[model samples]
Target: MALSLKLRQGLVSFFLLLLLLPSSFVAIEQAFYTQLLTNAEQKLEVHLYAILSELSMREDKIELTNNALAPDFYRPDSGISAYINDEQRLLWQSDSSLNQQFELPNVELIPGQHLFHLVSQQQNFWVLSIALLFDAGEQTFPLTIHIVQAEQMLLLPHQSFKRTLLQWFIGIGIGLLALSLLAYYWTTAPLTRLDQEIRKLEQGKQEQLNLSYPSELKVIKEDLNLLLANQNRQKQRYRNHLSDLAHALKTPIAVLNTSALSQQPELKEQLDRITAMIEHQLKRASSSGQDIWKKELPVRPLLDKLTGALHKIYRDKACPISIDCPEHIQFRGDETDLMEILGNLLDNACKACQHQVKLTVTDKPFCLIVEDDGPGIAEHKRQQLFNRGTRLDTYKEGHGVGLSIVAELVSSYSATITISDSPLGGARFTLQFPLEQ
Candidate 1:
């Protein structure tokens, strides 16, 4: 169960990280690229203004001198070009590659700051055009100076920034995986130990769990310890009750046994019957009381002792009793309780058979089957067998409390008792217990 909980937590964490990491990385990368583009655009606009100012001062020369100060003036990789024109006629071009025809409306040509399109070999360039107007007497000359730069130069830094961002993302992902493993171990270790401690308690080891934990878990540990202490107290109280009940019943049973053996035959017979009934009731009470908190008991030795006692009690009767049980089979029940159940069952089976009786006990899944070779009970009569004092024959010299006691004991433990035909041509009683791991 602890492993299942840890696995569930890890899966949830992994998916959460998967969703958050990408979003965080993209937001950071986009913010960085936006700032880089803004800076690049501002620098480009300043450089274009400076170049346009230089050209405006040289507009008087009909063919501008090639020595106009800027270096690499006509290089394709320079990322800058310029053109000069006046009144629908090109007077001078700074670079022939920059002289391509542009479709611009007349409104876009202003005397100060203006933006216009410049076509260069099928690619469009952004041109900042400024017209210089000089008035000598009554004539005004409109000299348009265009500064052109390719847009690709503005996007170069963004690509480089994205490449660096991808590298950082890979590194962070690996680190997070390593951190997740470390966190899983650190968090789950105490829980694993607690689970093992609980299993030990279930197996009757009865040791206190000692864990070094954080404040959040300290409360849980205290609660578990309190629960364990309460359970131990309850078990001890049950044991004390059984001992007291047994001691209380002992003297009365002794008096009854003594009175049953007195000299008057008729009175002795009546007292003997009452004494047997009292003894049966006492034994049933004692067994039931102890079983209130009984644990698992080894089966073979108890069965051997019980069958041996039965064999000796019926030794004078001319009968053969067979016993078959595995030497190592164990059952979850009280020893005294099972002894009573088996004693009553076998005693009744022996009386019903004339010359042969057989007893067998076998362990099965969640149950035990006890069978005897005797006259099997009829279907209709079996139901009545569980009622107190309901004997099938009045001539039988015993109180009919045996099967009833068995029924009561079985019911107390929430076990089932079923009567069926045995393979030995006799009765079978299958007692089904709750499954234990």
Candidate 2:
């Protein structure tokens, strides 16, 4: 459900491209169209001046003294036309306009004034018009010169530029995408390597982070290695203290056992209880519970060894222990913790079953199920079965502390143990371990 850093970066880049590329393309296209209009207006203004210079007055009417203008004025349908008007009357028109039906712009202008804009009719055109005063025998005449060019002329160049611009932008977008992908990989390479190293450490393939890393990650690497060293030292010291305590208590206990008071029935029982409590506490303390890092060990080999030993110990019953563990199934904790859990569960199943016992290992939830074919535990009594001194059977073999130890060990690893009715007609002890992933 959570997104990785690389994927987040890639998504940001993708959305930026989606927003920026089209905006850039539109901005560039609009700018190019404006430039085309400016160029078109300038060209029309030049033709207007050329036509104004060639005009003359004849019989008090405007006329062209000479056809000295751009060749577009002389060529028909050339998309460029010129006209001269006097007070709403057409004085003269260009040869190019003879076959075209373009109406001149109706605009009021004074002498020395000019106007340039676009006009829409059946088709669009750019118009440039200027007003001028003509002199003839002391009479002044106001005349307007008009020059118009079809919008198609500018559109041809505009569309061509758009196609060219689109191609360039598309190429640019693709190149940028490729570079972003390469940058994503380049930036995350160190993180990928560090992740692999951590996984190897978890699997007990490596003891500490040994790979060379960037400055940002080097501090973390050093801190982790130091923590591992400190934990090792602390565990060693704790074990040494427990060993010393055990040895110190051993002498007093031996002397008591040799005394006459310890031989009394009640005193002997009390002494035996004290000895069992000591053994239980020491075993519980020795467990490497819920360590930060854990090793992965295959379950099949250990299961074979436990089942073999249980068979020899309970040879009188000769109850079959059916193991349903895959060869690759693994336990992700201390080997001693796994052995203690499975050993106690299997041994109890063998003792409780009349004929059959079963042990199954599963990976999905990382659970161990031990079942037997004997009288099932009562629901009311099951809740108290794990108490330190609660024994359900009269077999006189165990101190009734195994399940309690199992509960403490399971709780340390953040695991759960449940007792339920088994299909085999006896109690099912289900030990589910926490999955690392």
Candidate 3:
């Protein structure tokens, strides 16, 4: 079935070696054995020619038919057997151990000149034959000689050669396998370290990832660092913009409040109108600041801090503020952004309620619910309550900016806010945020 990386690589290399190596080795070995056999036959031919020459000298005759040279003339410790003949008869023969095992071919007695032949008998013995010509004073005599040798002796060295080649193949294959494993580990180590660094970056454990890898991965490391730097710069710019906007709105708001305290009847009404307009603008500026800063605040802590501050501020009214929020439940918006949202909604609820306010934080899908026991808004006017400066009670101290601010903060954070009748016979506000952002 399925092969791992190391085994797959090893098997591919081994098969590739098999494809190219064995045929070449076999071709070379066969050529070497053929050459050895040929050289041995040539040496035997030379010895037979020398014996013919000696026989001609003694008899002073050109014809070898009546010459007395023995057929065993070239016998030696090398186990060579010899035979001599003319075109007519079997003249002489050698008595070697191989003579009884094979029938030597009559290649030399075939009535030809310079003929040679090699034959095998019972697949075990090799016979070599050659035709000869001798000159005695311008008269030539034709003679034929035959030699036979055992096939086992000629084939001995070839078997040993094959075994030696097998051993060499095994040794080389093992050496290559060891080298491949070492190379694989050396090459993959740096890549493994880079993987670990990337995981740490994903978990937000590190501000930047650094890795020392080979030349090919250097560009990847540089690109990641550059991306992190750009994100940090964007966050800083958003924070600076919110601070500048808040600073610009504070002085105008103070001047309008001072003018509202003046005593001339006509001026007082104009000053009051100016103060109301200034307060509406100030609430818009405050909500805008929270929108910009909300990206840094988590959800649970912001709700806790808001409920605590509202309870303290409304203590003289004897209204109870109940909070139900889970610990460590974080949100994507900034702290000031959530503060502005919850603070305005709770302040309005406290002012409307005669005795009790309830705030519930459910962790299931990140929802905030606020309810109060007071005179609730009429059903027909609930839709207009979010409009700027739309106060139902003219005697209330605020310029009706609280609900409008709540609406704007919720919109900026991409959160949903809804108004409904409370179970306590007053208004209920529910805000919901997506957990995954």
Candidate 4:
């Protein structure tokens, strides 16, 4: 079974969110907490100043005449608490702190300068303190206001806010996930359609793929269409070859029925022409082209196997086959196609070699250049070398199908094959594949 591209993409998206979303949630939570604390502090400052305003000057002695500035100041066990100090002496404390015992934070007196801190007493609390200086009848006195808020003041509001914030985070997280999934579906919709079309093709549910796809998938669609076209061409070629063979054999078969084709001089010549034509068509019919789904062919191992086999056959001649091929270099095609191609080339080169034949494979062009130190092919003959059964040397024991099949393969891969003279005074077949992306 083929791997699902959708499943692979889904996993990739999930991992990306897992790596990023939590950190975003954490940052939001911290910012929310900080903002909540800031708002609470601002409200406390208002109360701190109001208390100082309640102080009344009496007999040149400052007195806090209004203890009822806020109901919490009078209420017992209220989350809000306050105290007043005249210079270094204590003047008053809120009724809320009557039952609780804790040290109050010191006050500051840079005019409007105020201070706040958190401390643990009978319970944890936030303490805000401020100092005010009053002058009456040439007399100056120092007054400080301390506001004590029990932990409930902070905790209660925070818990309420926390619940709301958490709800939002969870809701947003779900919404974000949903959006991500939606975006993925939309983005890969064309691919999903293409996949279905391909499946339909494989199952024979459809005659040909005609699904509308995105621009990015156009190449894939084109390639598939090309495969179908090639298959159709093969069937067409088979029919045409059969028809031609039937027409061609009609005269020969009619003559052979009347006279022995081998014994009769004219019939024997006709038989040779018929046989050569059949062989030519058969060679073309055999090429099936590159496989629709091809596997990579490793350079070194394949070359080693081919060369090792070739060396044994030509062992008496002592023709050395040298290969300069990288282990990791690979041919992206059918293993059989590769074997057929290299086998024919190597066999011919080994047969033609005097002493040394060299095979060099490289990835830059994904090519194999085979060279032999034998009598080189002439320029005029090189053009016809890839023509079926057109051997330059008829005595060389070959039907000359090797280079022609190679020509067909090169055409399929959109590759180039050039035969030239080698420095070793022999033929150099440069079969270059397109560079792998």
Candidate 5:
């Protein structure tokens, strides 16, 4: 199954934590081990000086004041031991070294220096040694002190510390991951609701979008609601138009049925008219102008191709049709709807013009105005320009049908259409559309 956004984000956050935290903990453990080793060396160095203080110089040989030493040095199997050696004899060894054969790696050191090394016998061991020069009036003496302890004596406590730290880190990592998942789901709860509502819409369980959403999703909700409203409006318009078209065709069919001899041409004319009406209504019904998710279509090229076709149709008039549109400007609607609207408007303007037809497109307010230099319509007649299938210019065939379709297209896109007198001394039609974002 596909993962939802919330689950995907949570998994990513958890994996990142898992990857980074272990390396961080391992670094911290290494630092702690270094500090622990330093402390262990200091403890062993103290025992070396204790052995030095108890030594006595004699002409015959070097001697310790007594056999008694630190407790661990005497305790059997304590893992701690000391040794004292003269130039030519095995002078002494700690009681703790009773069953071992380990020795210091270095025999001598500089007068003021002590040295530490690791050696192996029964186990890995730490051996610390020092050389001190004693002077009498007539002779000199050299003695070496050695302290040896098993490495495990120092490492055992560090191992326990590591186990404790690992436990704590694992616990913290799991806790943090849980908290992250909780927050992720909480923050995305509204999105889940929105998704459910959309599915409900697709299944026709709901008439419209009605869920209350957070601000982050509020704009999207509003847009979806607008889309649903537009779809319903288009359906209603199609139903009303179909009913009216049927009523209209009934009269023409009745006229043809009643007429008989020497009325064949009249009957043929009525049939052609009925056919035209049916074709027009079918074309309008099929155009899906309620597409709210449509992308912007570039307007310049559509206008360009349209004006070219009109020029050919009205070639005898040779009307100078000028276009003032930006090459990169776009219209936010279905491309076919725009073509229908613009095509009808421009063709009407071309029909009415005597000498000039001009199209001006503006970006700031996102509108296009088409004006022609012909006899303009009076102001009173302009008010009824968009009524369904009502021809104010009865002299021109199909005038009402084109303008009604343009009005419907405009309504579907939340646009406005207005008629006014033009500066060119003719009628002007302006289509103002919503701004592109």
Candidate 6:
């Protein structure tokens, strides 16, 4: 449900790309269109000055001294037109204005003053105007020269530029996104390798980190290797101390067995109890308890070995032992710990059952169920069964300790053991180990 580092980074990159690209495109397009408008106004101003240079006044009638101009000005519907006005009465006009009908803008201007802005009639247009004073016989007449160009003229090039700009921006966005993906992968590749190595270590496929790593990870690798070495040394030293203690106690117990204390049944019984307690405690303490790294071991083979030995021990009873387990099902823990748990459970089932015993293994949480056909245990007495040295005197000599040992081993691995009625009309002992510990 949680996202990975690589996926999170990639999502952020794509989100930024989506957000920034459109904003950048709109800003650039608006700037370009503004520049086009400014250029169009400047061109119209040039046309206005050209018309002023050729104007002349004769007998209060406006005329052109030289009627020379650009070819567009001489053609009708050319989208560019010029007009000369004196006090709102048209004095002169370009040939381009003969067919186009447009209302002139009202204005009050001082001589030598110029104005430029946009106007919208049926369509948009740019209008530029300049005011001048014309000299006649002892009088001055105010004249205004105007230039009007249609909006369609500028839109043609603007649209073309928009298309070209869109293509270029799209290409640039794609290139940047590709580079972002590459950078993401390149930066996370080392982490991927480190993850793989850690998985191998957990599965017991490798004892320590073996691959070369970046400097940041190298210190972690060395620390892990040192921890593993220290664990090995501690386990070895612990086993040695338990072995030495057991040997030291055995000698005194042997010597007492040969002395006069052996003649008294009470002393002999106490010595036997002490011996049993020592053995039980040592076994409990030496268990390879919950470990961080464990090997995957097949359950079927271990079950087979335990069942074989149980059959030999209970050959006289001839009880049928049924094992229900898949070949591929594995137990992830110490092999010896597994053997101890299964061996004791199956042995107790064989001893309790009158004619049948069954063992079932499940995969999801690594469970084991051992059942028998004898009378099932009463609910009231079930809790006391896990207590040390708690058993009926009618059972075999070693029966008191088997279930207690099972309880200790199961607890060490953080597993649960429950006693319930079995379908076979006997007791069921179910042990469930967590998949992840």
Best by lDDT: 2
Best by TM-score: 2
Q: For residues 1-437, what per-residue lDDT tens digits would candidate 1 score against the true structure? A: 67789889889879977988899889988898677656644654575555554543333554432354355456645766666677877666555344444443243466765554444545555566667674534566787766666555545666787788889988998899789878988888877777777666544465566767667667887987887677567766765776676677677666765773564777666666666666666556555433322344567788778778877878887566676767766666566778877778778777666666766666654455666666778989988999877887544567677788888877766778989998877778787766541
User: Model 1 misses residue 319 by how many Å?
Assistant: 21
> What total of clashing residue pairs does each candidate reach?
0, 0, 8, 0, 0, 0
- In angstroms, how far off is 183's CA in candidate 2? 4.6
Listed in order, each prediction's TM-score against the native is: 0.53, 0.74, 0.45, 0.51, 0.54, 0.67
Give lDDT tens digits, candidate 6, residues 1-437.
11277678889999999999999999999999999989988998878777777777887787778766777899999999988898859888889989877778787888999888787887887888889898876899998888989889989998999999999999999999999989978877777787787767666788787888889878988998898877778878988999999999999999999999687988887887788789788888778765655667788999899899888999999998999999999887778888888888887788789999999999988999999998889999999999887884366467377788889999998999999999999999999898863
lDDT of 3 by residue, 1-437 (tens): 11244456656766766765677677867887887688767866675665566554235423344434444443443455666666765555554533355554655244454444456566555556667664556766666667655666667877777788768866876676667657755665566677667656644457676757778778887886887677667766755665675577667655765774556677666666666676555545544333222232346666667777877888789898887777765555545556767887788888889999999877556688999998987889887888877887655477666678778777766778888999999999898866643
The runs of at least 3 residues in candidate 2 whose Cα sits more than 4 Å from the true structure, single-residue gaps closed, are: 1-26, 51-159, 166-187, 248-268, 296-331, 354-373, 423-425, 430-437
Show pairs that collide, candidate 1. Answer: none
Q: On residues 1-437, what C-alpha lDDT tens digit does candidate 5 reach at each position? A: 11377678777888889888798789878988888777767888888777777867676565678864679987888889888775666667888889776754655577667777778766798878777776655876676777888888878887998999899998988888888778777887888888787766654568676989899889988988888888778867887787787788778676766768326877666565666677567657756556544555678989989999999999998997899998887676566787888888888888888899999988766798999999988999886877766776645466366787888778777788999999999999998877742
Q: Which candidate do you rate higher for TM-score, 1 or 5?
A: 5
Task: Report the C-alpha displacement of residue 43, candidate 4, in angstroms.
Answer: 2.6
Error of 4 at 199 (Å): 2.5
The better candidate by lDDT, 4 or 5, is 5
Note the Cα lDDT for every prediction shown.
0.67, 0.86, 0.66, 0.75, 0.78, 0.85
Which residue pairs clash within candidate 4?
Answer: none
RMSD of 4: 9.5
- Count of clashes in candidate 5: 0
**lDDT of model 3 at residue 252?**
68
The clash number for model 6 is 0
lDDT of predicted model 2:
0.86
RMSD per model, one decimal: 8.9, 4.8, 14.2, 9.5, 14.4, 5.9
